[model samples]
Target: MNLEILTPERKLYNGEVYGVQLPGVDGLFEVLEKHAPMVSALKAGKLKVLKDKSMSDTTSYAIQGGFVEVFHNKVTVLVEGAVPAEAGR
Candidate 1:
């Protein structure tokens, strides 16, 4: 799956991935390749993305509330606010 994380300022991430774990408004959900089309509201929490190979670990990001759209084998996440996980250090 191709994933993108965007904000009003700029595009945070855009690339291929195995899966993603999103903090949905209601709860958390995982999106894998070939996932059914849908839209979701995000919560203020962590966004975990599994990139690279099958056994690869996920990368975590911190973000505020936002919306997510899935289509055409791609997932786009738009956030009210976001910062790289490392930035929290």
Candidate 2:
């Protein structure tokens, strides 16, 4: 699946990913390749990107809050603010 994480100031990531773990308002949820179309609200937390099936190659970000839309094998995340998790250390 293709994933894009965007903020008002910039685009954080844009590329193909195996799956992604999001901080849904209700809790954590994951979107994978060929997922059903839907939209959801997100909370302030970590967003994990699964770069591949092995889950070894991955990345994470700390997002303030946002909305996510899944459609046609694409995942779009619009957040108020975000930064790579490691950057926060």
Candidate 3:
């Protein structure tokens, strides 16, 4: 699936990803390739980017409360603000 993370100031990420773990308002949820379409509110927490199923490379962001939309094999995260998570590797 393709993923993009955006804030008012700039785009944080734009690329293909295997899946993504998001901080939904109620809890955590994940979006994978060809996942069903939906929209959800988000909370301030860590967002994990799964670059591939092999799990060799990944990214994480510290995101403030935001919203997420999943549709057509794409996941878009709109955040109040965000920064690269210190724990990313």
| Winning model by lDDT | 2
lDDT digits (tens) for residues 5-73 of candidate 2:
999999999999999999999999999999999999999999999999998888999999989999999
Give the range where candidate 2 is weakest over 10 consecutive residues by summed lDDT: 80-89
lDDT for residue 67 in candidate 2, whole number 0-100: 100
TM-score winner between 2 and 3, please give it: 2
Clashing pairs in 1: none
Q: Write down the TM-score for model 1.
A: 0.89
lDDT of 2: 0.95
Please, what is the TM-score per model? 0.89, 0.95, 0.95
At residue 37, what lDDT does model 2 achieve?
Answer: 100
- Report how far residue 76 has shifted in candidate 3, in Å: 0.7
Off by over 4 Å in 1: 53-55, 86-89
The per-model lDDT (C-alpha) reads 0.89, 0.95, 0.93
| Per-residue lDDT over 1-89 for candidate 3, one digit per residue giving the tens place of the 0 to 100 score | 89999999999999999999999989999899999999999999999999989877888999999999999999999999999998633
For model 2, state the Cα shift of residue 20 in Å: 0.4
What is the model-wide C-alpha lDDT for candidate 3? 0.93
